[model samples]
Target: MAATVAQPTHMTRAKHWNEEVENAYRFQLAGWRDQVEYTGHKGEVTTWPNGLIKKLMRKSDECWYYFNKTRECADKDINKCKLYTY
Candidate 1:
């Protein structure tokens, strides 16, 4: 999981996808996703700032879902750039 630091794109630049990044991707259990703050959530409500991959996925997912709910226009360019964490 050690990739060279390439140019930053849709995916946030991780310092380097190492063991630490992999472990963070796994947050104990399914409920770990709840830790990420969305539109209507309490506590430390915040976007998925866990890492580059998570951040990209979360943002894109949120945008997509929001558009679905509110019928907003989606960003064609960004939407085209799918996150490839695995």
Candidate 2:
């Protein structure tokens, strides 16, 4: 869809996801474009109206992860987004 700048593949998703986790509470996040710049990362950076990284691990919708891109560390740690509860 033109609305979306890039469609991250399974691999990209995994890579980005890991990096995001590694830099959990970080604030300045390296957007997907930064990861696989050769691919559509650039496009995603430009086209995406709002730069929002879906911090998901267990693969569940309606989950809102509170990640501090500035701190480079997830507030609740990877897979510990402040979205849902058990």
Candidate 3:
């Protein structure tokens, strides 16, 4: 006779921050920095450095996790924003 093995029947889901929450955290930190706007012959333009985004993401473990997850999701989906590659 063959021995019988027990199989697990229940599974639990892990909790994670959604894109909206992640974006909210990013935008909150981004708002703290002053944006530099320039008006050249072409037209008005605005830009910010990636350093600011990195700094904000590193502020706390939660922030970093959300940022990292965002990047990972973005890698698979083209619709997601690719803010920090690292």
Q: Between 1 and 3, whose TM-score is larger? A: 3
Which predicted model would earn the best lDDT?
Answer: 2
Put down candidate 1 lDDT per residue, 1-86, tens digits, no spaces.
Answer: 22332332333323434433332332211122322322123223223343322321233332321111121222332232222231
How are the candidates ranked when ordered by TM-score, highest leading?
2, 3, 1
Q: Residue-wise lDDT of candidate 3 within 1-86, one digit each (tens)?
A: 22332333442321344543344344334332111110111122222343222333322332332233223223223333222211
lDDT of 2 at 1: 27
Least well predicted 10-residue stretch by lDDT in candidate 1: 64-73
lDDT of 2 by residue, 1-86 (tens): 22334433433222234444453222223322232331232232221123334342211332334443333443345443211111
Q: List the residue pairs that clash in candidate 1.
A: none
Q: lDDT for each of the candidates?
A: 0.28, 0.31, 0.29
Q: Pairing residues by index, what is the TM-score of model 1?
A: 0.19
Better of 1 and 2 by lDDT: 2
Q: What are the TM-scores, per candidate, against the unseen true structure?
A: 0.19, 0.22, 0.21
Model 2 spans > 4 angstroms off = 1-7, 11-20, 23-28, 38-71, 75-77, 80-86
| Candidates, ranked, lDDT | 2, 3, 1
> Which residue pairs come into collision in candidate 3?
none
Please give the distance, in angstroms, between residue 51's alpha carbon in candidate 2 and its true position after superposition: 25
Angstrom error of the Cα, residue 37, model 1: value is 14
